[model samples]
Target: MIDCISFFGLGKLGLPLAALFARSELRTLAIDIDRELVARLRAGQVPYPEPGLDDLLAEAEPRITYASEARGAFGTDASIILVPTPSDAGHPEFSSRHIEQACRDLCAALKARTEWRYHLIVISSTVFPGTVATRIAPLLEQLLGRRAGRDFGIAYVPDFVALGDVVRGFQEPQFLLIGSDDEESHAQAAALFRRIVAPGTPIQHLSIRDAELAKVAANVFLCTKISFGNFLAQLADRLGGADLDSIASALALDPRIGGGFLRAGSPYGGTCLPRDVDAFVALARSVDLDAPLASAVRDVNKAQYDLIERHLLAGNPRCVAVLGLSFKPGTSVTIGSPAFELVRRLAQRSVRVAVYDPAADARESAHAAFGDAITCHESITACVAAADAVLVCNSDPAFRGLAAKVAPDRRIIDPWGCVLGTHPGLVRIGRDQALAASLLASRRRKPSLRAVR
Candidate 1:
């Protein structure tokens, strides 16, 4: 009977979800607080760059509507709040001001309605554990002057998709998690998702608090894998003749350690992984328990970044070129990008930095963030031409053949192993014997800057 749906907060995730809902033959109302963004969507233009999103939105435009207020969702069978729940500036917990504001507006919408019926509100945003049981549900109950299970239903089902592959992820999530204290509410949410997700997908129904904790724990586990891989790489560097890739491959065959994040290239740097790791640690401390493993995982990530920076600075280059800006190619989000962090660290030590990214969104973000401190280039060749050394950060396909194209005299730091056909100037992270020797050689003499010319 749930044929109509409304989405709140149409950013990268929300807008796509709305389009997918419409594609499923459900009338979707896409609402957001940003008038400019809403205006763009109305005109058939996507504000952000996501693969296949433009075409998907174009096809579903006939079934979707755009609005700027919560009132737009008035007649929908359900309203899913997908607003941002960013981490606190100096703390590990998430700030729920946005979620609370959205709920308050929805409550107001509920007040204006004359008919009495049950409306389900689903929260797809990431929040701290027990947030719904302690804060969100109580706020809604107090505001609407009605009980949750009797008059309204609330469900917590956070999205587990990456930025670049969000559209496909929605169509085929590994599993569907529906969390609600009310049995009827849980069944209703599950039924809605079953219509959209691929067949045979596992569905788990749990209490609201458990679902909140599960989301954070999942990301924290991924971080542990990445940090462990980096640790092996560091150990390999200390003990010569041990290739990290080969070791990873051998371990992956065990089935116990699959190749998800086992082979290390760079530190795990994104909006989710690092933040969730910290949040999990903080959550443990809040309960008077110590999360030493999570703490070590965080420390290992920092050490991996430091290790890369130290190697890049070994030759004391006057200027270095960074090849990638986005966290991992495919998207333009640079919130917790390791490449940006590298540029910042170099700038702090007075090393001039020039950067380039094939994605236009990443270029704009980098230009906006660093301003005059760093130079942004249009092409990979131009970016490399401006510096004494080149650092290939991400495995963007555009970066292929860079090793052979760049000046042979200039050193190239390729952490991701994107460039094939090794040259004397080419160096890789986690599996290069040349790096140790190069570090020793650089210490003996000052490197010439003429290689850049």
Candidate 2:
């Protein structure tokens, strides 16, 4: 909106941030290389599920425009690049292909247009240390034929918004971290962000690498806390057998350990944590060092998902009605989700998958990801209609409805312990295990998991 080309890649963060700018009457233009993605957005569609995002896109669409190429989006004059740097394989290995491709598109854009003399190039993506000066700066300046700070306004403002709560996060951000070349660029970027975030959300200024490292460290800490809970849960399972609630309560008493992420269902899923941990360790490995904690975090998460498979296929059933498919409740995004992984592994077996999610369109999701090979149903009833045993795949509230619906004679092998009421066929595995037992008291508090017989 400040008379600049806002280049955004990886629709995850780029879309929401662009929406924030667009809603403020900024005339924002968002670019994605995926032609299908462009078509969907133009048609008022969001492929992924995030709370409040569909509405946000609808509200921001009026002021927003889109293009597949940088000539239309960047305009060679002024641009703000928001390219996502994601991790892969629980290693800190980053794929800058998406980032570099966006930059190349921008470079062409700068060469093509001869309109404006001033070009302020700000990066709002996650980059590793020394990425800006060593990697991004040279490529950008060579493309623009200008000095870093003089001819253009260069800054690094890493995004901290989480996946599920992106739109709402724009309003009440925890903090804004910016790494700038000069005071003017910082001020301009700050003023722009101020328009989007709440009045009091502090914009902390630091060196470019520091800003990058800060974002990484923040995600690393969050993953660490969660992994710590998971590790403790394993220990609790060992001690309490079927009474993990006590261990959970005792841990909550420790103020240093918050209650969040402690309530374990499945391991953390979706796009962020796994790759973030990988990137953290990969960065360390590049320096001939190893990040043991981060490495363990990845191992634990992967192990949890793997364990679900071990427990499920142990007493294999033919028609397994998976309770939930999305990562967690309140959203339906199965990308890299543990439940989705479970479904995939389950599919490889002779088992037939009947998946239901509260928010996701079963046909659209299944077709886009795996096609008609996987079955889709409206309610748990349809999914469980012919099931030999049920598996609690996701933690959607709809699982509770399933608990109430499964007939008394039905046997459900819920790994997530969704169906509590005693029925003839409700054989929940992972429940007898020490880890599953500890969460028993914790599950009792939730109405959905109350388990009626």
Candidate 3:
């Protein structure tokens, strides 16, 4: 029974997992190199925005300890490495330097301990297929001067989580994937997951490399679904009378399809999906196997953005308000966000772009992407009030009432079908021409519906 656990890399995913472990009544130590971040956590401040995190942190505070050094993690019975394994330049493979360095530091801590005690080492970071067995295991064994399976148990147990819904995903994972060098290692990792996750959670134990492949494969499959939905959406838009929402909803009823990630919206973008697809493609290529489906998924996602750009530009709005800058709602991460890219392209075209996101740091993210070229609004109403067109990029709940906020002349480009009320200027991406024509006709009757540009 692992009563105490140490977590490496106290970033977005790491912190939440640590909190959950603490909430589960386990003594949890969270270690990070970032001094300020450690300071913030110790001060009872969350480093990032996550739903239910603050409350969870409060509940788990007594059992959770924050530390800036790796040595602080020495006494814990198990250590899970959750550090960033950033993608290598010009390739899909993730650089394992961060996790490697963490393992080295952890080795030093283990060496310094006078008494030898068995510890479970779990790699929770996403890595390439062969990373665990070839790279991580060898390096850890060399540094610690011990055998992985015998001296210390090691397992690759990547978390299947999305940024916005991480808390829920961690608490109630569909299934836990464990890749271990030995049976004992697998059981140790599974036991730890069982402690934190829901009762009777299904667990799949695989070889180290298989688990690595499964992690990326899962995301790639999801990206393929999203891209497929977008492709269907485009078909619906082009072939009048075809409804994407209805089609997707019907397709989702199939037991095999399972109805998740089938919604048609902006291209799939975030920290994980795009990168994972690219990595999977690269992984396939490394072994002389061509992944045409994965490649197509990537191409389709990029093309979806182009389609959106064309639609927004076609309207020729004097100013466009881009609502929801984050990749998706409920999180503040904006990496590969369609809204972020849309703002950049619109600004380059001198389209007068105004952006707002309820969760994201609009000013900071906008400045980082393009400095002062776009206006960041504090409120959604403020963002769309002056614009002739508003593009709701993400499916944030705050963006649902955009129809009531904007004037009838203001065009609402909703990709996610978030806007409910029927307004003349509301342009749904996947809707047929008849709906668009009706909206246009209503605007023409009003006579004040001239295009701003």
Show model 1 residue runs off by greater than 4 Å: 433-453
Provide the global lDDT of candidate 1 against the true structure: 0.85
**C-alpha RMSD by candidate, in order:** 5.9, 6.1, 5.5
Comparing 2 with 3 on lDDT, the higher-scoring candidate is 3
What is the alpha-carbon lDDT for the whole of candidate 2?
0.69
Pairing residues by index, what is the TM-score of model 1? Answer: 0.94
Clashes of each: 0, 22, 0
Q: Give the per-residue Cα lDDT of candidate 2 at 167.
A: 83
lDDT accuracy of residue 56 in candidate 3: 91
Q: Tens digits of per-residue lDDT for model 1 on 1-453? A: 688988889988888888888888899988899999988888878888899899999888889999999786668888889998888548889878899999998888877778868888899999989899888999999998999988989999888999899999988999998889998789888888887789999998889999999999999998999999988877766543245777788888888778888867778988888888888988998999999999999899989888889779978899999998999989988889999889889989999999999888898888888888889888988999968889888878888789766888888887666678877777777677566456445645755722421
Instruction: Name the lDDT value of residue 270 in candidate 1.
Output: 80
Candidate 3, residues 23-71, lDDT tens digits: the string is: 9899988889999999998888877888888899999998999988888
lDDT of each: 0.85, 0.69, 0.86
